[model samples]
Target: MSEAIRIRVTSQHLAESSNPAQQKYAFAYHISIENCGREAVQLLNRYWLITDADGKKTEVRGAGVVGKQPVIAPDECYEYSSGAILDTPVGTMQGYYEMQSADGNTFQAPIPVFSLVVPNLIN
Candidate 1:
């Protein structure tokens, strides 16, 4: 059986550098996961295919996001936060969630790409 997973991401500015000489930015993202399926689904693992504007690709594999593999029930949702470090100011991010149903069937849900652009970096 195939299950559907829904996720939403919100970027937050946790802190900023005071010195003008410092060239760096850190973005904290709040992710919400919703199980819209008819049955409970457990988030087994996660795969991140992060791509920068310079074509640099970074793949992150882990057991769970934010140290919790939440099992979302039908029509239920959960939220978590994470951060990423980038040198440049402008970029985008997209990835997938690997989830399995109670019957041990696995499926993937696509996470939409979101922009991360600093005010001064892009027009």
Candidate 2:
């Protein structure tokens, strides 16, 4: 697999009932993994490093996101969508994914830091 991890994030506003009335916030994300190499790759695990505007940090370590440890063949891809809760109006998240190739080689792809900011909150 390639050394670079391509990630695209799209955040949307949840229903007003989904969040506290006093806090203006929303949740959204789309994670897609593509195997661009010649060999097959199996997702081993995932780790998320979430940071809030209050300087609090949380580390989430677990096996396979959304359950199954998918084995992606060359040119194939898998995608997952999830939501996040943020205490403040703005925050960020970053993490990594562990994967093993068919040849018994393992590697990690770093997840780029994405922002979670409420629209019009800055103005």
Q: Score candidate 2 by lDDT.
A: 0.77
List CA RMSD, all candidates.
Answer: 2.4, 2.1
- Counting clashing residue pairs in each candidate, in order, gives 0, 0
Q: How do all models score by TM-score?
A: 0.85, 0.86
Which runs of model 2 end up more than 4 angstroms from their true locations?
Answer: 1-5, 15-26
The residue-level lDDT of candidate 2 at 116 comes to 76
Instruction: Give the residue spans of candidate 1 off by over 4 A.
Output: 1-3, 14-23
lDDT of each: 0.75, 0.77
Candidate 1 overall lDDT versus native:
0.75
Q: Against the correct fold, how does model 2 do in TM-score? A: 0.86
